[model samples]
Target: MAIALNTLVEEAERYLNASRIQDYCPNGLQVEGRPQVSRIVSGVTASQALLDAAVEAEADVVLVHHGYFWKGEDPRVVGMKQRRLKTLLSHDISLLAYHLPLDVHPEVGNNVQLARQLDIVVEGPLDPENPRTVGLVGSLVEPMTASDFARKVRIVLGREPLLVEGPQMIRRVGWCTGGGQSYIDQAIAAGVDLYLTGEASEQTFHSARENGISFIAAGHHATERYGIQALGDYLARRFALEHLFIDCPNPV
Candidate 1:
């Protein structure tokens, strides 16, 4: 069965309640491609390569984590943005994106997915007051060495994760998938022994060492892939629509 773009948008909006949370980019539909969507292609970013893949697959909808029209981005349609939009428009592929909402959703969120993979039971949001707080605090099913936990992350994420060992066996942890290294201090303040995120800066290494907290930088793209894919699968199953998660490799 084919789903109407409006219906899909309404369903997703209700599911995430994205409008309630202030985000960097306009959430939901950024680019209108087609009226009816029977097939969906989900990816981490709506880059040119991703657009090409979606076009090749004849995808009726392209759902992504990183959509265009970001805050501080040049509003003018030019350069790479122009090319990307042109491709989607020309191919009639609708674009749907969710940023913080996809990261924080309880069941189909990136953080929750990663925690489940690592057998981490979420206690609560790291920032109790902020509903949009991306990082989460949780505990492992059983205590394990920092190195052991690190190995588990690498195995699950299918990438070599950078690790910074701390003074304790890893029981409690804080994690935010996709370029959220800045939340390290929050984890430390929350009294978590370990913190995990995708992408790392030079300062991240020093912060983990000095803050007395373990750190792991699993690949940003890899760690974030699960949420949107799971969401797409759910949507497909719910609406009886065709869905394909198109993965575009990103090293950083």
Candidate 2:
């Protein structure tokens, strides 16, 4: 089955509530391809490798969590950016991306998906007063040592997480996926036993040590890989179209 490009974009935007969230990049269709769509290729980032794979797959749309045109970036179309745009334009493959919306959605969000993967029972937002906070607070089924919890993260994420072992066991936890080390302070304020994010800053170690909370920096790509796939699956099931996820692995 096939649906109109406009219809699919509208439905996705509505489902994710994309317009309501302010993000660094544009949240909807970044590139126009064909008028009708039947197959989609999904990925974490719309890198050249993913685009090449989508072309090989004969995809009508290339759906991704990361897309082109961010704020403060040089708007001039040249170099790597030009090459990427040219590929999409030449192949007539649409690019649909969702940033903050995909991160914060209740059901298919990165945060919720990660929590489920780690067996954490979600309590609420990390910052209850802030509606736009992307991090979440949750609790494990049973308390475990900081090292033990890091091992679990490694098993679940298929990557070794950098852990700053603190004095507390991991029961109450806080996490924000993908370059969210800045939220460690917020997690500490919430009185969580552990805080996890995709990447960590130099200051993150000090903060966790001082606050007596365990901290882990799992790979950013590893953490964000699930939400885009889930979104693609939802779209494919909704429209009865074929969907494929092509992962371009990033160690960072």
Candidate 3:
């Protein structure tokens, strides 16, 4: 059974609490399509590949964690942007995206889903005083050497993570999904033995080494593949609509 396009968008907005969250891009229904939607295709990003896949799959709505019209991007619809928008417009496929909200959500959020994947017992927000912080403080089921934990990350993420090991075993941990290396100091302040994120900077190595906390930089795409799938499963069950998650692999 199909649902109205507006209903799907509204429910997603309410479920994600999108309006309350400040983000660099618009959160929901980036482009309007058919008045009704039956099948939804979700992905980590709204890349041309995903859009093409959605079209091939005959999806009515293309849902993603990253969407177009990001802040500071050239507002002109030309070149690549023009091609993407034209594809959606010509095919009558809606575009729906959620950035920070999808990262921070208590259920089906990227951070929380990643914790489950790695068996991290969540403690609390990485910074309790800051509502804007999307990272979380958590603990492992058992303490392991930093190297052992890094191996686990490699196994689960199917990519060799860059590890900066500290002298201590890892138990208490903090993490944010998708290019959140900048939060290392916040995790340090939270008294974590290790910190992990989707990407790392040169300074991240020094932070972990100098702070005596282990660090892992799992591939940004690998680390973030779960949350969008979880969200799609949830919406599918809720609305009795068909949902599919297509992963266009990114080595980075």
Candidate 4:
């Protein structure tokens, strides 16, 4: 079965509530291709390799959490950007990207999906006052030591996270998927025992140590993989279309 490209984009926009959120990049269709989409390929990012995979798979559209055209990115299409756009245009494959929208969506959001995988009971937003808070504070089903929590993250994400240990036992925790280490301040302010994000900055270590909160930097790709998969599966079921999640591994 196949659906119109516009129809799919519209449905995704509605489901993710894309318009209301402010993001670094535009959310929704970043590039247009074929009008009718039958097979969709989903991934964490729309890198050149993913585009090549989509072309090889004969995909009608490529859906992803990260896409081009950022706030400060160079406008001129050249070098890697030129190659990537060339591949999509030559093959007539549509590109649909959702950044913050995919990270914050209630059902298919990255943080919520990670929470489900790790058996976290969400308490509330990291910042309760901000309605669009992308990070969340939660508690584990059972309290465990910081080392044990790091072990759990490694087992689940298939990558050893950089652990900044604090406190003996961790009960309440806060997390945001994909480069959200900066949210540690909010997590600290919220009084959570631990904080988890995909990547960590130099200051993250200082913040974690000073605030007495455990911190973990799991692989960015690993932490963000689930949300796009969930969204792809939903789109497949909802539209009765073929969906495939292409994983292009990245250590960071």
lDDT of each: 0.89, 0.93, 0.94, 0.93
Q: Give the TM-scores of the predictions, in the order they appear.
A: 0.96, 0.98, 0.98, 0.98
- Write the residue-wise lDDT of candidate 4 on 148-238 in tens digits: 9999999999998999999759999999998888889999999999999999999999999998889999978999999999999999999
Tens digit of per-residue lDDT, candidate 2, span 1-252: 999999899999999999989999999999999999999999999999999999999999999988999999999999999999999999999999999999999888999999999999999999998787789999999999999999999999889999999987789999999989998878988999999999998889999998888999998999998899899999999999999999898999
lDDT of 2: 0.93
Give stretches of model 4 more than 4 Å off: none
Kindly list the per-residue Cα lDDT of model 1 for residues 120-181, writing each as its tens digit. Answer: 99999987876657889999889999999989987887788899898888889999999899
Please give the range of 10 consecutive residues that has the lowest summed lDDT in model 4: 124-133
Candidate 4's displacement at residue 9, Å, is 0.7
Candidate 2, residue 38: Cα displacement in angstroms equals 0.8
Residue pairs in candidate 2 whose N, alpha carbon or C atoms collide under 3 angstroms: none
Please say which candidate is ahead in TM-score: 1 or 3: 3
Error of 2 at 35 (Å): 0.8
Point out where model 3 deviates above 4 Å.
none
